[model samples]
Target: MALGWKLVVDAGDPHRQAAFWAEALGYQIEDNSTLIERLLAAGTVEQSLCVEFQGRLFWRDAAAVRHPDDPFDPVSGTGLGRRLLFNRVPEPKAGKNRLHVDVHADRGQRDATVARLRAHGATLVRHVKEPGGEWSVLTDPEGNEFCVS
Candidate 1:
């Protein structure tokens, strides 16, 4: 059997990170209302356990997005592949990201990708070019660096 993994980000505001990353990756936010409602009806979760995000009920402090065709568990709304999971952390992001994602656009679409990423709140930190190829290093609003090539 194949195994799946989620790239979990520790952030002061997990929902905000999820929102940013969802747009950055063109992924859909996972909706967990069914489970939330079930838990509330069963008295397992408090009435205040669910929070409204963008006018929709969602579990506070955590959210995820996945590839459009990926499988998800109906009960928990957990994704099975190409997932990014954002969880709450008390501390703010500082320094540099030792591990970051690299996105590859079409052969000649790097510049367009950079523009789109910047529109999504990423800033171009630097650009690199060589005999081999070219790429742009960018940082998200929270200062996490990623590469586009």
Candidate 2:
């Protein structure tokens, strides 16, 4: 059987990170409110760990986005494929990312994609060009590095 996984990122503001990544990747934000409500009602989870977002309860320390067409659990709102999870951290991001995501745009659309991402709060870091390829390095709203190619 194939192993399943989701990319996780650390962020100071997990919900904002989820929102930006969802828009960037054409993904849907996972609700998870039903599960949270159930946990709260049963006293299985602390009420302090939840917050209302868009009038729905969400875990205060994490948020996620999943591919629109991916299969997800309706009860927990967790995606079964192509997902990214952002978890809250007390400290701000520092130094470079050991692993970073690369956003591959449709042919010849990299620059346009980068521009759109910038408009959505990404910071243009620098452009790279080598014999092998070219791409733009950018930082997300929370300063995590990613590339557009």
Candidate 3:
């Protein structure tokens, strides 16, 4: 069987990164509020470790976005598949990402997709036209690279 996995990215503000990726990828931000509330009630987790964003409780150091169709734990609101977790870090991004995500546009909708992402604060780095294909590279709100093709 194949192992399950999720990509975790470092960010200065996890909530903002989660929101941006959710909007850009048409994903749903994992709530995790139920788990948080439960933990808070049980005194299992410190209240100082969480924050409220968009009327939802989130861990201050992390946030995540998941594919809409994936199965998730109802109580914890944690996605079981196709998840991208953003974690808070003290240092800012200083170099190119050694690993990046490639977003494939539907059919001939690359332009529209790229524009939508730009409206969400993704800045275009450059456009690449190689013998293999053409793609546009853009950095997320936190300077994480991703491509639209």
Candidate 4:
């Protein structure tokens, strides 16, 4: 049996975080507006539970980014594979991340990639050089750490 899962990160501003990650990973921000509109029209969900962002309706506390090629539900726009869900949290990131994502780049592309990420609000934490290889640790806009190599 196979179990399916999506990576979830806590964020102070989920929509903003989703946008950042979407650009960083070349992913698409899931657009659930159609379903949200349907629910709103049918009175199934409260308007207060949703928000208007970039002229689209989104769940107030969460947003997601998905691999551009992944399968997704047409009605809900929910990705069926390789997704990252960002949910709002009351507090900011407090300490080091227990789990982090590593982004691999082609040989000699690490510096360019790191620079690009920096332009997208990722701050370089430090560079690690070891016998195995080299990678740069960076913190996203919300301070979650990831590595680029």
Among all windows of 10 consecutive residues in model 4, the one with the lowest summed lDDT is 48-57
1-149 per-residue lDDT for model 1 (tens digits):
97767898887766777787888788878888788888888999887656788767777778888877888888878787789988877888888888999988889999999999899789999999999989999987777899999
Per-residue lDDT of 13-88 in model 2, one digit per residue for the tens? 9998998999898899999999999999999999999988767888999999999998999989999999999999
Clashing residue pairs in candidate 1, if any?
Answer: none
**What is residue 25's positional error in candidate 3, in angstroms?**
1.0
- List model 3 lDDT by residue over 1-149, tens digit each: 99999999999999999999999988999999999999999999999999999998999999999999999999999999999999999999998899999999998998899999999999999999999999999999989899999
Off by over 4 Å in 1: none
**What is the alpha-carbon RMSD of candidate 1 to the true structure?**
1.7
TM-score of each: 0.90, 0.94, 0.97, 0.96
After TM-score superposition, what is the CA distance of residue 146 in candidate 1 from its true location, in Å? 1.0
TM-score of decoy 2: 0.94
8-82: candidate 4 lDDT, tens digit per residue: 999999999999999889999999999999999999999999998878999999999999998999999999999
lDDT of each: 0.83, 0.94, 0.95, 0.95
Query: Which runs in model 4 stand beyond 4 Å of their true positions?
Result: none
Q: For candidate 4, what is the TM-score?
A: 0.96
